[model samples]
Target: MSILNSSALRPSSLILIGIPGLESYHIWFAAPLSIIYIATVLGNVMLLLAITTVLKLQKPMYIFISQLAFSDLVLSTCAVPKMLDIFWYNSREIQLSACITQMFFIHLMLVFESSILTAMSFDRYVAVCNPLRYHSILTHALIAKLSALSLLRAIVVIVPLPLLTLRLSFCSRCIAHSFCTNMAMTKISCADITVNNVYAMFVSLFLGPVDIICIALSYSLIVRLVLRLPHKDARLKTFSTCSSHISVMSALYVPFFFGTLLTLFPNRIPVHVHILVANTYLIVPPLINPLIYGLTVKEVRQSMYLLLQNCKNRIRLWASSRVWR
Candidate 1:
């Protein structure tokens, strides 16, 4: 009887109102999103493999980039599948615990990736602005230390999310979007979310502004140095190298900043718009980041092609061995 009653009490629909009046948009969202999900995963996986196998990409820049690719990979994997599930199957019913879990990882990855980008920006500044001092400043030990710190920062800052979420019992388990996002999930909690709200807002303001400002400042100094170069060709080379990173930074940050602002005023903006924009914040970077580097960096692309050829040859050898066996 108790089991029956508990089962009966569960929310029937995952969506609050089932995707608004945009029924037509479901096809648009589904088809493209599925492609994006596949491409993001495949692209990042290949990049990871290439980084691991190729000796040339073993430097600090590639190490940081591999970390960036990895972070974006996880970020997309966590957020995109749930979205597709929601859109395709109408499986909106996520439990409270699962919601909290998703929120934790999602936020953790976001902060960690942002920190990695900051590190990468600083790396660029050192490599270009102070080329003579670059190697000594960005030693292997220093890179390793920075990597550890980035991981630690992510763990520490994200610890509060799960702990605080555990304290608050949810009233309704129906998340508007596909995934259980920190800001969206918190809004639906019946308990006084004063602590969670304040902490989230604080983290956003502090971490976000500091990262953006620091990155901008790094680029500003780098720009000045690049301009001081006597040869126009040398100046262009410096700018060209940084262009890919700059493009990625802009794409990743702009949507995220806008989405954060929208969350602050959730009531005014229609829920679907909020959800789509928020989803975009998670989606676009993962899809385009690899392409940016692959197209811009000649060596990375060549290495990636070589890695694929090696994979094909290995498969062929395995097949021949299997036939002989």
Candidate 2:
């Protein structure tokens, strides 16, 4: 019987590699992954709150930063907790329904993240290219509109993905990744995955390249405008404002695009290279985004400082009131 046809056997039966057995692998894998998960969740939350609660961070650029952080928050939440379970609890077994839900959220967040980058680039373009019109261009109403458009873009593009995936018949239910990633899941399917694979290709070509191109074009325009300014300090500061973003964008996109290509052309790469590139592509961007923003963006750093002070003051006030009581 084909792996997919034997539905009676657990899907995890097909996917797991060496590690003695299910019980041992769970304990070993779960412990270290837990640390990564905690930091991932905590760091992103702190970044989000720092952006939201600080009055000085209410500008358009920071608003986009907050939106990006929020999307990463949602993305990490969907993937990491389940990953922790598989590692710690010997619970690699997943219901078909849960797998579908996981896939949907994963792609949704992916689409939203790319959309946010595109929007942020546009925000920079307007700020640097047309400074006088920036406030007028990026008003509260416009921010709301952009957010709505971003969400719509994700839903419209990725909604078809799940529907297409549902049509695939599983040949072997085992998924290789720690969690039910799309390519891993598709690999186990018995049915022809041509349509689903084609759709994945469409995402890479249309949504993926389009976002990267848009960001590059926006920055190119910004650079051209910055060069026209007479003040040396202004030109340098403008480039500095965008340098972190450009760096993070490269970090996120370069590996991501290569990983997508590697997945599509598995024959072109060695197994170890494929695995290393794919994992790095997935993990590094999520981890580094908050760090880049925190270090490079003055507003985020100041807000974090103020938030820490506020927390200390609150604790001291509570202690004093308790002593009086």
Candidate 3:
């Protein structure tokens, strides 16, 4: 009898095989992963705080950046802690409901981040190509609406994924990857997964490519406009403004593109390599996004410097008082 056809009790929990073939080194892997996770959280939090509290950063671009920071925070928090649990404690058991929940949020944040990047690209396009109307066009109200719609689109598309997973009877409960994903879950399903596969394909084709195309187009036009500027310094200044966003876009899309390719051509790649790329896809962007923004954007850099100075002064004052006492 086929494993799919055999009548077995529906599993309540699934075992995640974290980094297959690397079980012996899970503890060692946890060390660097823990540091990256902590840095992602702290850096994103600091960026969020700086964007929110600083009066000078209340502009539309900063507002979009804050959204990006928030999304990164949520994305990292959703996956990393569970990954660490598997690494450090060997706690591989995850409930079916919990797995579905994790899958939903993971995809949700991925789509949200993509949409936000597209929106940010548009923000840049307008600012560069139509400087006179940039403020009028990308007002706070419009930025809020764009952010809301990005989130809404993600929720609407991703909500059905977990429900679809629920309809399938799994022949196996062992997830080869560290995290639950649509493909990972569906791979174990006993039933016909045509609908699930179609939806996944639709999301991959529609969301990823559409957003990438929009971003590319936006930058292309921005570049054309910048080149036409009469003053060299003005053109340089305008181009500099886009450098940070371009860096961020590269950081995100390059790994993601390769990771997707590895997933699609799993036969060509080793399992451990696939797992490493998969983890890097989620970890690298969040880890570097804040640092890229802080170092590249002048306003954010200045604000962070000011914040550190204040912290230094407070620490010095406290130490001096303690010595006097």
Candidate 4:
């Protein structure tokens, strides 16, 4: 029996099934996945560029938006390329160390994104609730400190996850999802993963609820403050300023919460549905976040338009010079 058990153990290299039950459609899936990944990268990069070059956008809110864009870029880049590889090239063999590293970055980015969103909410709260003191409260120094703290918090929270995973003995080396996630890897371990499960639950319960409550409270205060504003236009403008943030937050968290629930209750949901939701949870925010900001925020839109016009003018000048030559 011991010999049989030893023979049954998988190799150190793990095979990632891009979408377990949908293997036949992996080729079809890769196209859209690639498109989303490309769009995400381009959109976020454009947002970052706009923020960096545009003087008018050098405010606290845009700074936080740029940070969020950076986080989305990092998060999507960490997962989507590997996912595309699995789907397009059938290159699914990921080493244990590599998988652990991937899991670490993915979770780190997730937490960092959450922290940034929380910070953005606080920024909004200060801007609307105490407009007179907004600049005093959210100074450039404070923004830098908050950004640094967000990264540090993410590192502190996510560093142990891979370590805990490393302690386990993985009997099965096949990950059902496209990416190597902590939960997915934990489920494959032959050891008693009760501790890992508990830790994951602890993190989720602590982080998710705290972020949600803080955001909800911030918005609640904003709403109340807006209601008390005597001018309807003032209230409308304040609420409008918040709508983009709300849309981005919803895009980031809703699918994530739903995906977490699906993971917890995997038996109720179909495997394909779970996988799709998980992918969406990972992919959708980065893809849509820049679009939300670009379309909703006037400064960003104006900056993007200016940048495009410059590019067009440069191209036309080059063509004209070539004709003269």
What C-alpha lDDT values do all the predictions have?
0.80, 0.75, 0.89, 0.89
lDDT of 1 by residue, 80-121 (tens): 787787677656555566666778888888999889889999
**TM-score for each of the candidates:** 0.90, 0.87, 0.93, 0.94
Q: Candidate 2 local accuracy as lDDT?
A: 0.75
Clashes of each: 1, 4, 0, 0
List candidate 3 stretches off by more than 4 Å. Answer: 1-8, 315-325
Candidate 2 lDDT, 1-325, residue by residue in tens: 1335553333434443212224354566567657765766666777888978877788888888788777777777776677666656655566777777777887887788888888889988888888899999999889988888999999998888778777777766656565556677678777778888888778878888889889989988988888998999999999997887787788778898887778766777665466556556555677778888888887788787777788899999999999999
Q: Give the per-residue lDDT of model 3 (tens digit) for 120-224.
A: 999999888888998899998899899999999999999999989889988787888999989988888788999999999899878899999999999999888
**Any runs in candidate 2 off by more than 4 Å, and if so which?**
1-32, 230-232, 268-273, 316-325
RMSD of each: 3.7, 3.6, 2.8, 2.9
Task: Output the lDDT of residue 140, model 3.
Answer: 85
> How good is model 3 by TM-score?
0.93
Q: Write the per-residue lDDT of candidate 4 for residues 297-320, one digit (tens) a residue.
A: 888999988888888999999999
Global CA lDDT computed for model 1: 0.80
Error of 3 at 185 (Å): 0.8
* Model 2, residue pairs in steric clash: 3-171, 4-171, 4-172, 171-190
For candidate 3, give the lDDT: 0.89
TM-score of candidate 2 versus the correct structure, residues matched by position: 0.87
